[model samples]
Target: MNKLSVKVKNLVIGGNSPIVVQTMCNTHTQDIEASIAQCKDMVAAGTQMIRLTTQGLDEVNALRVIKEQLHAAGIHIPLVADVHFNSDVAIAAAKVADKVRINPGNFAQVHKDAAVQFKKFLEICKENNTAVRIGLNHGSLGEEIVNKYGNTPLGMKEAVMQWLSMCKENDFYNVVVSLKASNTVVMTEAYRLLHNAMQEDGMLFPLHLGVTEAGNGDQGRIKSAVGIGALLKDGIGDTIRVSLTENPVNEIPAGHTIANFFESGENEILLDSVMAQIRRGSSKPEAIISVNSALCGNTDTRSQDAWNEFIIKASCLFGPLLLDKQIDDFDAVPNFSHAHNHDHECEHTNEHSSDHESNDAEEQIFVEMKKIFSADRLVEFKENLMQAARRKFTHPEYIACPGCGRTQYNLEQTFNEVKRRTAHMKGLKIAVMGCIVNGPGEMADADYGYVGQGGHKVTIYKGKTPVLKSVPEDQAINALIKIISES
Candidate 1:
């Protein structure tokens, strides 16, 4: 692919440059102050570019004011004017804005001079040396293309190709192409196919990425991340936006997160792994505790105090029991036989005579809990709880396993019941793991959970901490509900 050098302020799109994160302002562009303030917020949050809707002359008027304010503040980020329906707005915005985005499907005339008028708009943009973006949305495809190919990825791609062809025919190579769809699967698949097609044809058009109308907050962020993040992993997108129904400023963070995925290679650890790791205990001892002694170089008092408190609580819960040889070496420990007998024996003896021990079981339990409850562990537990709570209360999240004969309850049925009951919640996470062997670890991050044990028995946890065990099968949901409600 040839390097792209379409200038937006001082930043260049495409080529070896870092991915550009962009978002559209949700405020009425006619309100210059509101639009300028929102743009300032987006700039502060690391947005590389911003687009404002330019419906006609009135919005164009606001654009002029916005340009003045941006210049006064010395903010030089590229500003794109989003135009539709009228070529006049596009022509007018090209006079002042950094770039002008046009939807070809709507930029038409009802008379014989339509083509002439459209050419005039392009000529004006060319004269001003402003770049153009040919943005094609699946929701607003031209009637001819939709009728020929239906509303599939193929149709969206065709619409974009047609626009690009027009730009090429008119010698407008300073253009970007975006083929967007709201469906995550379609959006991702279409971009992949189009990207390949463009490569095969030697078309080096810079691609702008987005998933349109992606709801609000977590849902929107998740959908955009999955769609845009996937393409970015393959080195396909050059610019991106996260379209949400909420405040436009919120979109800036989401865009930056996606861009940073490609810029820093952080998405490899972020996707499908953050939640999983939170469920499984960390492999490193340093991950288990977050201490702030001068030796460790931590000076934050709040973090140090939190670490101390957690250690105290965890030690209190498990300290005495671990000190008892019988309980410490019990079969409950997974892979007890895998360790070298000498090492296992050493671990057992160390716990028994350790300074963490107490004569009283209750006191020992608290001490043990505290020892295990370092700041890192506490933070991990809280993250898990928040994820489970969000899933339980909001969307369809599952806690299934690699099934075995020990399983009694229908895991799928339990999952559906919990999801249905908690769908009204905005941020609830519930887990339904199969058996006690792996249930506690699997449901460690859930806000409320149910794990099937032997016949008719279930264990419940509220955010990694076990609240109740051995509740009968019939009362599991009710128990979980009560715990979640109280929490």
Candidate 2:
């Protein structure tokens, strides 16, 4: 079987090459500046390639302008034009862009001369020395394949193979294949099956990886990471894109971060940076307010009512700040308390004195907050927090096993603590395993890990590379932390 290996400009896409991370621009192609600005920004943030929609003549004209501007700026990164329902646009884009991405699912269904249209499109790409991405989306699978195989992994793989065969038949070999399904399991399974089938058939076609309609930032990123990350870990994917509903700018970073994980094995550092930014931004108080109102009820009920009133007043003060900053779920506030530990002092203090002190304390707290968080700084802080919250899977990830009777000291507890402490740290995976029996294998890919042994001894491994043979249980966390922090 031929190994799947293909090159895009200077970057290789398969056969032991590091997976390429890519994204598409959502900006209107006619708005050249906006689209180019976004493309440049994504490129700067480490996106390996950019894809843009070239739907009609207007978009094709825009592509030419955008390509000229990018070339002038010395950005020679590959640009792919996504074409659907139109082969002419594909031909036009092939003239300018470095690559053309076509959905065979739709293109093959176009007309009786669909194959001829595709052949013409391939000829244009070949003349331009442009690569072609045979993007096969599950949502648009060919009717015959779907009917034959019920839209399962087998069906998806068949669809891809059919298109790949067509490409070969037309003597178009500068091709990459992508089989995408919104369902993660289906996506993963389909790719695995396709990889095996291609290998068996002795086909050497590079694969494009993605989960289409991956929803919003948070959920979409997580799903993409898991699906694509798993495949990359297994040496399956050649190029990858994380589809999201959010801004295209956001997609670039997420793609780069994932690529960075495999390229440098530095996911922990990325994860930590994201977490720290989240913690810092999350710690800020949304509001501080002074409220004075008489309550008519039993002491407990009156206290509850006063607390509710205080919360309402505080939310009113902070609501605008939250909205202006685009912070979600800002209405939820952290708990506050002013209780003193010394009961004796509280008893000795006069009731009137206590009331006066409480009022004074509230005033002081409000004043202190105002002093620390000026409006400008607060806005900046919120901006930083939002950036942190933005989904970018550039962190060290772990797949630690839960401890069992093969066991050691509180594996779950240690795992939680390590995760908490390293939450703000990125690109580091620390596995806390129950025993050495299966621990080493489970944590083989982990950057740093501790596998428990009976009676206080544990084995530590780093980056699927074994380190110290054994260490005491009590010292494992510190040792792991030190190694991760240093790394």
Candidate 3:
């Protein structure tokens, strides 16, 4: 990934810079005493940056006081002014704040003369050497983006792109960007989309990541992990603020924990939000899926009880569960377990009770992922998530287990070889397995199977029936591709 270095006061972001953990103060900004105390606490808690809300003119002076007090106390972390609509306040904040965070959607709405306002805003930021973050959110994307792409990830990306384009026009390079959503899936997918687009355009401004309106407690922490963790694993983020609906101080630890976990090569670890909204308002899901989120204990030299605890937590979440298939904001990679039972339960294999809703959901996932991962796993997702699988898969459907000791051959290498050759072919179900006993049975819905027969040999199946027995491992890749193309 291409990295860009951006200066916010004394802190530099991107391009070999350490991922900075940030927190925002929940206290009213005009309350200088409370703001100062919180800022001190945040700085003490290892916060790299502190964000304070600047809602009006009064808060502008408040920012100055907070900065002065923090500086007096010898804390020099960059202060970011979180401004929504008031560019007047934003301009005042730039004079005092190290960085000014503006919501482009609301900023656009408030300033009808966007060109003039942005030009002035950029001039002030440049004059002061104050950085800016052009943050966009799903709920606040304004007329231009909503008109073009609706309230979706693409809209969020285009919204930021429009602002970034304006920043370029004004010769403003001290800018960061964020596209935040409460749903981890939506948030992660949005970052991936924007990253690709920016990389293609050679734009590598540091990115600020967060899950907006993520509610309190364990759910908040797990969600913060899933959304931000996904991108960090992909090496896409520069700074992060885990927006827990709790004390801002709690957010620091959560954000830093996520950073440290991803940094230590725990990339594949997933936290299960279980795709539930906690039955918001009066609305209720027909059934309840109870999943207590867990993380592998954070230490070296822990007992196997730690590993046992990990399995126990995971098993309880997915145990004896059937796919009620509650799709979250996006097609998140986290696998969850949920049992199905309720008054409104209906059985229809191919269709949900609500076709329009399902179509909307499926279409949204398809359009979003098409931008982010089509070259990676978009093919498999199209087959599984969208209904296109019923018509004909546009990509190969692959299944492989993390092999065990009973396995006869090297499943990982063989699976890779098979996939490498036939990844271009569509509408084929291929299975690669470690052991022969459960392997063939597990290939239940697959169109073809490649199970280990013995050392360096593979059994190729046409549907459920074995068509070729004990083919050489070297010949298996060609054999699988040949069968798919021929069939």
Candidate 4:
């Protein structure tokens, strides 16, 4: 497939260019000063493209001022207007933003009406030379497509193809495409299907890669790496975003690590050594023990760089294996004498020493490993890897959007509270979303949703039905828990 390069301002995506790393602002777009400040910080953090939520004409107009100020300050990075459920705003934004992202599913309730709106949107974008990102996410596939294709990867591919066909019919080529999902398996499969279909059709659009609503911290990074890394390794991604439920600035480096891991051979060498050892089967435990010891031994997990490298390498190594079902789980010591007998207190030895005296070589290594990577942390890693791969759910699955300008409440704080309160609930898919426009639909298959509805209010939903409408912010979590408890 010959891929066309998309030009958003001076930055280019696809067509032999390096993978573009991008992020979106979490500040309210209407707050011109805050949005501009955030944009400058994003640029300083190495963001190639920054997207701001333009939920209406007001936000769109604010975006215009934001872009002008950014350019005036010589921050020439492209600004993308994120518009949903409002085609008129998108059309107006086409004149202002360097790029516009629209979810076709929410562009209109009716598919035909969406097509009509999108055609008009394309005309304006073409007139202004603005780029468009046909962003379609899983769990948000329109009813018509879901009924026919069952909300699967095929449905995601089919839905996007219709819009791509429309773009071709309208002769608009300045476009990129994305198919994101919080589930790594679903996300990877959707992109693969779309890539193959586009290859067969001979009109491939540049792909924007992301694992949407992946919660923050190590789990989020691992999940994004597993989904994005798999496709990137297969030569399928163009631009990438690591969506974390944290400060948007943090996404830049996380994204760079994933992109650079592929460019550099360091991670591949690490993975190959482990794979070879696993394949030998002669001393699998010895191989894993040695690798873990080398990687984590004498390593301070406190340093951001060290932690990032360790997690990224671990994700690259174990995430793909788990996702493909090649391995069920990972254990650093499977053949040790103390495998099932070791106590967390290290009762038989000094707890502070990595150089504890032990007759068994495996025991010595195991003790050292437990010191560096605690037993609890190792277990946590395994569980995180399993959940990220969609193989198991030892903890509550959180689908949280990296809050945007459209966000009304304190999303990160609210999501953390939600996780803290619901920590005991296992195997449940819960979503803590930021706003109503994309919240309900993007939460996808989450069994429960806590969606923010501006003015310091929230609506708790049980699988798309609002159980508590306009609940006060302070009482929202309690209400959500109450509903869940009742259910």
Candidate 5:
């Protein structure tokens, strides 16, 4: 079924439009200048839409000024207000932001009250010609939905469908919907279920695809690519956001890589070739053991962007197969030949000498293999890939939010600390969240969580129960570590 397009300012999402890539700002919305600066950076990085954290009325007012300043500077990029647990804020933000993102599950306390508030918010959105995203996360499903569907993909679909029903009843169509999860299997399956349900209902709203709480670095990228790529492969996703714990600007290039790979029409040739390779590789036992030159496809791993592109391609190729249980493990190490560029070697070895050390062809192969795909590096990548696919867990799975204005603490630094300290522990889903608003609920599946509370405090949780509350910011990590160790 053809999806209905939702327009946010000059950007059109869904229908026959291109897959738009977007990112959210982490700067405090109250700091209008910093928000504006971040917005400028995000825009320069090719972000189609920008979402800022809007937690209260004060932030809404700040958002107004930020948008005004951006427009005055000739940047008409659509600004989205990400509102959670507040209906009134969502309504107020609709008038100012080009789009308003709300998770209806938390719009109000009571389910019925949420419906009423959501309707009121929709009325305002319609009046102001603002786009809406009925964004729902797997870990944040409402109690009622969880009661009925056990917090599974069905629950997510059922919850979002309720809001979509309200939209249909109210004749509101300028809306996009998302069901994000950190687990690639859950994320992809949820979207697929929702897509089929929408098709059955005879109206398909555009999907905003993402892997929520996907942590930083290569794992984040691979996990996001796997989840979002699976959905896009089935012609499901409309707009994509590669959420990372690092700088939001880094998200744009990663998002674009995934978007470009699955883009329709002209890119279909590349997509088919890659998909065919994945299919062939996953089918036979012999194919599974080796990662040869052909497995890398035509992507030349010699340029500046080669490593990043390879990560995207590798995830896209192997993720689906692993997620679907077609292959359990790959035995042999990938040994793609490095391009014979001495300059690239110098960049790595930091050697200015042109006449470098001499080596035979066999010795050179060993050197390249050791430098690029060492045994330890291969194991790390495999473990992460396995964890991303949810097939195995050899290391602690980190679920972290990309810091937003609500994040009062140094989220990136704190999360890294949590990861470093907890690296030795295996099979634990540890979450290092930014703030209390959505942290506890979003990290519902985590065995342990480190949530930031305001006023330089932190809350430690053990499976939805607050084990330690109001620990000092400096001591929170130690407390969390102790709790995990004691358990």
Candidate 6:
């Protein structure tokens, strides 16, 4: 980890400081009473910081009043003014608020001479001991940057990089940064690329992780969990805010849940393991084979219905998408196991065969064995048996996650479609995961990953990093086709 720390309103952030939990108030900032009430409510829910939208001078005035009210009432929460398209407002808010967030695109558009405006803005923030967050939203990058980088993750990182450079050039380092998207994969990868860029530049400004427009209810919670949790597991985020369509208070615990899970005393190793797995992308071949073989031949519990049970259990280990996207509950699995062990039959036939017609007998035994294992055994044969035995694969390995509350599309159907299209591309291990949260860590060994990023959107990845993002539901499959064809 790079050496860096930032101080905001008496609180230390970045480096080894505990991950901060934040949430933005949805109440209109101009409505002073409503703003104070909502912000207080959020603080009660454990939000360490609060962001309020300051669209213009009026909101700045409202922020000042809200700050006063909180102080008079004996509360000491740091206030952040979210300003876009208004450097004058940002300058004013910076004088009062603990932090002022400005969009690089908005600053460039609002001030004709952005260099002069940004210099003055930095001066005000520096003087007031106010921190700055050069917020970059994926859908809001400037036209020139878009033309150059194609509204992609690279474009998002470049937009922030330019501004970050400006701050450093002016000798201003009290900066936090955010590179966000509604799409989880894009958001996660952009943060990763930006983090690495900062590390190379020797700047470890704390990152604020979020997935914008994460809609309400259980859907919102799970989506935020997957994206935020994934990053936290890899030790990427410093502070986080769960962006939701509901009341701002609802977003607090979601962010806290992720922070809490990774920060748990016992889960420290789990987090480290996830990061290592993602970096290496695959484990030793011997290790994987040994585990699979042991799983396949569990002699400790061999019974009347052992073989089928073994196949089902092994399929569940890799995921049931191989056997067909159905239930995996052990109780519901029933007596799918077979009455006899097929491997012993081949050996017995070989031993009893007469010398005169040995080849024909062997052929007969082989055909019968194939017939016995052929039904409901396509997945177990290629993925389990052949893979464990280290033999040549007979089919392309398609790995996909069963859908969860966070999943946006019909994952089972999508997996089938992907397999139907790419079954001919043998010897490849491709993964399809429900969301970016698990895609990178879980599918580390896969050659490619097709992950759900947002509603009706997919992000295609070459291993752990994203290659294509925010492809529409209709075109994502085709985009995947292009990735495969090109690769």
Each prediction's TM-score against the native?
A: 0.58, 0.55, 0.58, 0.87, 0.87, 0.58
lDDT (0-100) at residue 370 of candidate 6? Answer: 36
- The per-prediction tally of clashing pairs is 36, 19, 0, 0, 0, 1
Off by over 4 Å in 5: 110-112, 264-305, 330-332, 335-379
**Model 2: lDDT to the true structure:** 0.63
In candidate 1, what are the lDDT values of residues 145-231, reduced to their tens digit? 768987678887877776667666777777877877655556776787788777777776888997664444344455566567657
Error of model 3, residue 138, in angstroms: 0.7
Candidate-wise lDDT, in order: 0.61, 0.63, 0.64, 0.82, 0.81, 0.65
The sequence of per-residue lDDT tens digits that candidate 5 reaches over residues 166-208 is 9998889999999998888888889988999999998999999
Q: Kindly indicate the candidate among 3 and 5 with the higher lDDT.
A: 5
lDDT by residue (tens digit), candidate 4, 1-487: 6789999999999998999999999998999999999889888888899999898899988998888888899788899999866888899999999999999777745445777888999999999999999999997788888999998999999999998999999999999999999889999999999999999999889999999999998888889988888888778899999999999999998898888777676556656656765687733322133223333335443346555555665676667777877677666333434443323423423432344334444456555544444446566776787789888888999999999887889999999999999999998999999988789988988999999999999999999888888999999999999999999
Top candidate, metric lDDT: 4
lDDT of 3 at 396: 60
Q: What does candidate 3's lDDT look like per residue over 225-309, in tens digits?
A: 5566557756889999876545678777666666765564433322222324324421221111111112111322123333223
Segments of candidate 1 deviating more than 4 angstroms: 108-117, 268-487
Which pairs, if any, clash in model 4? none
- Looking at candidate 6, the ten consecutive residues that score lowest on lDDT are 284-293
Lowest summed lDDT window (length 10), candidate 5: 284-293
Candidate 6 segments whose C-alpha is farther than 4 A from its true place: 265-487
